[model samples]
Target: MNPLLDERKATVEADHQWIANLEVDERARTGIPLLKVGFNETFGYYISISRAKADQVPANYIRKQTLKNEERYITPELKEREARILTARDDLHKLEYEVFVTLREEVGEQAEAIRHLSRAVAAADVLCGLAELAVYQGYCRPEMVNGRELKIVDGRHPVVEQSLPAGFFVPNSTELGNIEETSPLPDLIILTGPNASGKSCYLRQVGLIQLMAQIGSFVPAKSARLGVCDRIFTRVGAVDDLATGQSTFMVEMNETANILNHATSRSLVLLDEIGRGTATFDGLSIAWAVAEYLAMEIRSRTIFATHYHELNELAGMLPNVANYQVTVKELPDQIIFLHQVQPGGADKSYGIEAGRLAGLPTVVIQRAKQVMGQIEKHSKIAMGLREGL
Candidate 1:
C-alpha cells in the first residue's frame, strides 16, 4: 500500500468533526433544514397576524373616535364614563394590531441578529472541533503540556492509532533544541529507505503536526516550536488521470511542478515516491532537480521520501539539507523494520527480501536473485572500465 496516501486518508478521517460542522453551517445558511430552529419560532405568530390583518380599517376608525371623545370631557362623572367607553372602544381591534406590529418589529430585529451571529459561531465551532479531534485521536495533545513552543509525547497516528488494541501502538516525541531560541528549520529534509520502511509514517506525522497547530491545538511532540504555515501541499499518491489522458508519471510531474511554482517559504510540503511514475533515470533526474529547487528556491519546510539513493549527495552541498533513513536490521533471509527515523542515508534497498515477505513464487525469487547478482557484477565491471578510460 502507498504509505503517503494512507497518511492523508488518516488525517481526513481524524478531522471528521470539522468536516461535519462545516456541512452543518452550509445547510443552515442555505435554508437546508438546520438542526435547531432560529428566530422563526419566536416571531412566527407576529408575522402571521400582521399579514392576515394588513388591510383592516379598524386602526384608523379607532384613532378618529378617540380624538372626538377627548373633546367632550367637562363634568367629573361624565368625563370618567366617557374615558372608560373610549378605552374599551380602543381596546377592541386597534390595541391588538399595535401590539402585533410592535412584536413583529422586535422579532424582525432578533432574526437579523441571529443571522449575523450564526456565521461567527459556526467558524469558531469548526476551529474548536478540529483541535478537539486532534487531541482525541492522538494526533496532538489536547492541552499545552509544556511551556515550549510545541510538544508532542508518544503521539500516534490519529486514525491507525485508534484501531490498535488499548495497550499497543508506540508513541514518538519531538522537540526543538534548547541552545537555539528557535529550532533550525530546514528548507528540505531528504528521506531515503527501502520498501516497507517508516519514511511515509514520519512524513505523515509532520503533516499531522502542522494541521493540529493550524487548528490551534498542541502538537504530538514532547516539545514543539511551530511556525505557522499558510498552505500544506502533499504529493504522495500516483494514479493515471484517465479523463485527461495523462499517464501516472505525467500526473505526478504536474503536481510536483504546481508545488514548485506555488509553494512559498511558509508552506509545508510532503512528497513521497516523487519520481516513481516515470523511467528510472528520468525519474531520478527530476527528483534530484525538485529537491534542489526546494532547497535553493522555495526554501520551504519539506519532507521528501523516495527510494532514490543518488539524491543523498545533496547533504554535502546544501547547508540545511538533512539526510534521514528508516532503519531495518536483516538476517540471512529475514528482515525486520525498526520503524525508527535516524540521521544519515541508507546503504541498500532490500527489494528482494520485501518481495519474499509478499510470498513470491520460489522460482521467481530464485531467478530474481540470480539476475540481481549478474547486474551487480556488470555494474562493477563498467565502473572499472570507466575509471581506466
Candidate 2:
C-alpha cells in the first residue's frame, strides 16, 4: 500500500504508539542520570552516562556495549519487539522509495512557479536586512543630484569602521563641488597625507557612499549629496598578475589607462598611490600628469591619494583642483593619526616617522632624518643657483 493513502494513517499511528511506549527515563538501574537516549542503525537504542559514575551500575545490568567513558545495556524485552518492527520497515522502505519518486515529479511540475516565489521572498529578505543594517549603523539617506558634485558630511569607511572597536574609527567629511559653486564640472581634491594616515579610507568612503545611494540604500555618512555618475572608476591598490606576465607597474598603468579612456565628467574617480611602482621622478611625473588629466580634461570628481606631495602643486595651477590632507598630531616621540581630513597639503610626508612606527631600526630612522635635512639644504642651494642664472 502507498504510504500517502488514507489507509496508511493506521500505520503512522501505530509507529507513534510504539515510540511512546518505548520511552525510558534517567532513573535507570545505573543510578546515574542518562545524558542521551536515542536510536540509530548500529546502536538501535542507547542510554549514556558519565564515566565518573560508571562504578554505580547494578550487577544485573548486563553491559551490551562498552566505550571509553560509559557503558550501554538492553533489556531482552526491547530487543525482541524492535527486531519484529525493523523487519517490516525494511520491506516497506523499497516500496516507499518508488512512490516517493512519483510524488516528487508531481511536485517538480510546479518548480518554475516555486522558483519565482522563492526569488521574491529572497529579495524581500535582502531589503529587510539592508533596512536593519541601516538602522543599526545610523546610516543616512543620501540626496541624489543630476550633476557631477558629491558632498558627504561626517562620512566613515564602512568596512574599516566596523572592524575597529566601538567609537575608535574617526569620521571625515568631503566635497567634490560646492552646492553654491554652480560649476558644470566638479572640482577634484588632491589628498596628501603621511603614510598610514586615512587618505585611502577617505577616498574609498566617497566611492562607497555614492554606490550605495545609487543602489537605493542608505550610506555610511551623517548626510550625503551624491552627483549623477555613469561609472565610479578606481585605481587604488595594485597587484602583479604573475600568471599573466604583467608587472605591478604594468597593471597600474593599464588600470590608469582604462580610467582615462572611459571616464566622463559625471564619473567619480578614486586613485590611491598611482604611479608608485616605478622610480621617484618617473612616478612623480606620471602622478602629476594623471591628476592634471582628470582635473583639466576629464573633469571627473576625483580623490587622488598619494605620497607625492609634488602633486599638491596642482591645487594652484588648475581651477578645478584643490588640496586636502589627513590631520595628524606630532608628539615628542610619536605622531597620532587624527584621521581627520582638512583643507591644504601636509607640510611633509613624515616617511621616517611612518617607518619608525613600522618597526624600522632606530639607526635607520636617525639616518633618514639626517638625509632629509641634507636634501632640504641642497634644494635651497640649488634654488639659489637657478635664481642667480
Q: Which candidate tops lDDT?
A: 2
Q: Candidate 2, residues 190-220: lDDT per residue as tens digits?
A: 8888888878788888888888889888988
Worst 10 residues of 2 by lDDT: 380-389
Task: Give lDDT per model, in order.
Answer: 0.64, 0.79
- lDDT of residue 52 for candidate 1: 26
Q: Estimate each model's TM-score.
A: 0.61, 0.74
RMSD of 2: 7.7
Number of clashes recorded per candidate:
9, 0
Error of 1 at 19 (Å): 51
Please state the error at residue 116 of candidate 1 in Å: 4.4
lDDT for position 328 in model 1: 85
What is the Cα-based TM-score of model 2? 0.74
